[model samples]
Target: MGTRKFQGIYQLHYEEAMGKIQTGDLLFCSGSYLVSELIKKASNSFMSHVAFLFEWYDRVLVFESVESMGVRIVPLLHYMTNYKNTGKKYNGGLFIARHEKLIDSYFDQTLLKNMIRTGIDSLNRNYDQTEIIRILTRIKLGVGKHKEDNYEYICSEFVDYCFQQIGVRFPRTMEGFIYPEHIAADSNVYPMFEIVS
Candidate 1:
């Protein structure tokens, strides 16, 4: 994507952005840390992580797998504020992306509720350390095999799996090698808005 196009995308405050997110929307984050830096380098994209949105009982939650937290649901506002407070130096910060086709074809109150339940079903699963190591090793050595294991998940894999549950598949050449850049670059998804702070 061009810098000018990215710059022209709508920007919103965290709170306002949270209010606008709908279930199944993708949340791509540019984290401020060493690991995030490594991920950006490996993927060659601005976003290092991705999550699926799930709004429940007036609170919006993000479903993602992190090295520290594994598969879990976190309050969306809390996630954004944590980054906003700490990631002053990062560019593109955090942004929301929506699959235009999915929104038009699959999004509805009932479908969203079901999607949230799908995410809830996978809570507490461990983060896929083997996959992370494999990805890093591949990026380092420039050769390795990519494997997909659902017993645990990395962030993008979790998002990919959730969408698959609803019959929407994000593109992947290899089964388990979904990266943040893959989702960001998907033809089906488009940037809606970004959070500046």
Candidate 2:
């Protein structure tokens, strides 16, 4: 049999993909730890976490909101190769997706810079610990509307909020529901490369 593709696209070594990244790119991760597994199961998606990216001079930086460390920025290389300063590659798949809609004429350098600045300003924001529980409870109870608080965020919410800053809304139309799956399901978002860690 042919080698199985990661999310329907051939995987590439981390080094091979590093140079092709751009600002506004989306990073989707399928983590394997206990909390990762729980999040994936709860969301019914292989992707448990998501982050936004922007290039800084020469390095690409990942902006994300993680449980242990709220909103923060780190070089993309450090994140994929030596995750969390552990001196080891990340323990799961990491892929990049591009927004075809915004990458067009609609989104210009000004918006890109503004979005990057917004992400930078969001650093140190509180991570909403109750977010997972609330999302799970809403899902289980079939709640249609989700009230939102931008002050604190889960991973995906942070990504959404940053993109929303530039007036580029997520494709998911469901009221108050934005997650890894929803972002990946956006018709304009397409897989570009996967890290062969």
Candidate 3:
């Protein structure tokens, strides 16, 4: 019989490092590219105090030092469109850590506002959520374009939607949120974040 080799064991062992997050967290979410660009452009911006970048099994999330506000950073996978429930697949992306601590800084009003605005804006823009979702599904089947052209406008509207939700001033130049659903992983788009308390 020929010699068969099984999988080798290595001494190096790594554990999954998940940031402790809880409900009632105050998160300052923005686009991944926008934050990175701002950091590149403004060396002394508020993001200068980034402790570490957090990578989840799905998406890439960043962390920043928010001075007295505790830890804050932008959430990944937050695209400008309402693609989360479209029955499409989005691969992994970036994320921000210290979710629980961030939520402690502000009331739940902000998160609620952001979600509401996003949903409403899509409706107001004459975007049939069901139809758009169906189109996204068709695109995945290679039947049509990914609708990349509409992405820019959708993203722009998303920013406005978010602002309307929080009713607070955030960086205008910010971009999109990185979510796992956008990656075309599979039919089910996984949520990259849990509420941080």
Candidate 4:
């Protein structure tokens, strides 16, 4: 087969992505370690795919690619849930992609910036739950001007979901269920499922 277009490999830039996690950065993250481990181990376990959602300080990033860690990118959002395993029959908080639907709700820079601001305001107002929910809602609903889903979905989709309204596609790699945007810099990481659950 020709090289895979979107493979399971860590592909988001650390600093740049973190920058997005500003005041309006609204998204629920389990924890940094869990998100980080998912990507590091996915590359090792065959199956050919990796997806993750990550957060840094405050911002959250979402990213997905089929060409492994360093290759082509197939970005998606707004209805996309968490990543699933390679061949698992069942999973949760994971949504498959429908290019058209995603393109309809992409996030732009200004919108992201504003969202960050919103998040900050929520935090300042002591609205932890609301802030997080707002962040995820914007991501899932697609707010902002540019309307591109660069790498923000990862963090945004960490909250509650009504997958029933949206169809989900199971992850196709060992490293599944992670948000696409977030990642741990360390080399030694594994998916939450791999941690002897």
Candidate 5:
């Protein structure tokens, strides 16, 4: 309904914007929901969620972990349309970032295949509620240990794990804690585009 931009980032129409997204790009979303609000507050960031993108059988799929649906891959269109279908006023837009160094210097067909396979293998994993709690706790206390287990993962953690499979590492303060803002702010990842519909 209204235009909003951060640091001169422009919002484009969602349908026309899909062409800009490429495989292995990171998507940071400022969702419209109570949980999203809490995440934004706790993380001190505009983005509340993050997902990894890949082209699967000609369809762009986003790999992410959410409390409602653990780790899973869904069509990118589905992700963009979810809030619209709910008939709720959603203000959050989707922001995309790509690892230019990885794409230009390291990415190849085999590595891409391995990344997809690794993401697929992680399907059905549970969302790490404990990690979320820990993050909140850390935010409150201003200090805490970063710990995570393989049993489950949070959104950014899942993305980090997938990239690690292909020998790429995103910035992480600790072994297990990775926030959406961390990935968004990483120097290696270049902001490509944003979409709001």
Candidate 6:
């Protein structure tokens, strides 16, 4: 396999990045929040969160599931300048990544619409707390072969499930748990821009 690099520290203004961003793009962050650190530790990667992008009538929105609020949509500008209505930029590196094959190439309007619709449907769904606990427990205890069924999802898994609507499958390690690092490591995903605080 050819070696690949994570996103660099070079900075780009959020306005410009958002203007150029396409629907079905990705956002990644290395947040310093306590939960974020735990995810980084679990995945052994610097990135703690993964979210998808959606373009809606001159607005760019982020589709994500957070521990505090579960699946929700936030304006792209929320991270660029103020985060969670705070007067400061979000606490970490914000990145825009593109899927080489699926974004503007292989995916058709039908698939794209289906993918986006699935993501929209997940709005207000609770973050999968049970799966997260199992993940952390397995991470610390080294247990394997655990699985269950549920409609709730963590951030990365939520994105993965949405992509499945378009027939794209990401790596699901540890009994179908998809992490932010797993999405980052995808061969088709490449960094396009970054916003450093």
Which window of ten consecutive residues has the lowest lDDT sum in model 4?
Answer: 156-165
List the candidate 6 regions with Cα displacement exceeding 4 Å. Answer: 1-4, 103-106, 144-149
Question: Can you give the lDDT of residue 58 in candidate 1?
Answer: 89
**Alpha carbon lDDT of each predicted model:** 0.75, 0.78, 0.29, 0.28, 0.76, 0.80
- Per-residue lDDT of model 5, residues 85-193, tens digit only: 5644345777877876556864576887788888888899999888888787777886676775566889988888888776777776653478887777776777777
**Which stretch of 10 consecutive residues in model 5 shows the poorest summed lDDT?**
1-10
| lDDT accuracy of residue 30 in candidate 4 | 23
Q: Candidate 2: where is the Cα deviation over 4 Å?
A: 1-6, 143-145, 171-175
| TM-scores for the candidates | 0.85, 0.89, 0.26, 0.21, 0.86, 0.91
Candidate 2 vs. truth: CA RMSD? 3.5
- List clash counts for every candidate, in order: 0, 0, 30, 49, 0, 0
Q: TM-score ranking from best to worst? A: 6, 2, 5, 1, 3, 4
Give the alpha carbon lDDT tens digit for every residue of 44-64 in model 1.
777788998867798887788
Regions more than 4 Å wrong, model 1: 1-8, 83-92, 105-111, 174-176
lDDT (10s digit) by residue, model 2, range 42-126 = 7777787899888778888889999998999888888666888899888888889888856687556787777888888889998
- The alpha-carbon lDDT assigned to residue 26 of candidate 2 equals 91
lDDT of 3 by residue, 1-197 (tens): 00001012111111122333232122222223553444323322222112223344654343322322322333323222222344432221222222222335555655654544454344334322332343344434534322322422222233333333544322221122212122111122112332222
Q: What lDDT tens digits, residue by residue, belong to model 4 across residues 92-179?
A: 1221121222233453445444433433332212112333344344445654222222232323222111111123232221223323
**Ranking according to lDDT, highest score first:** 6, 2, 5, 1, 3, 4
Report how far residue 46 has shifted in candidate 1, in Å: 1.0
- Residue 110 of model 1, lDDT score: 71
The predicted structure with the larger TM-score, 1 or 6, is 6
Segments in model 5 whose C-alpha atoms lie over 4 Å from true places: 1-6, 84-91, 174-176
Candidate 6 lDDT, 124-193, residue by residue in tens: 9998888888888778886654354477888888888888887777876747677888888888888887
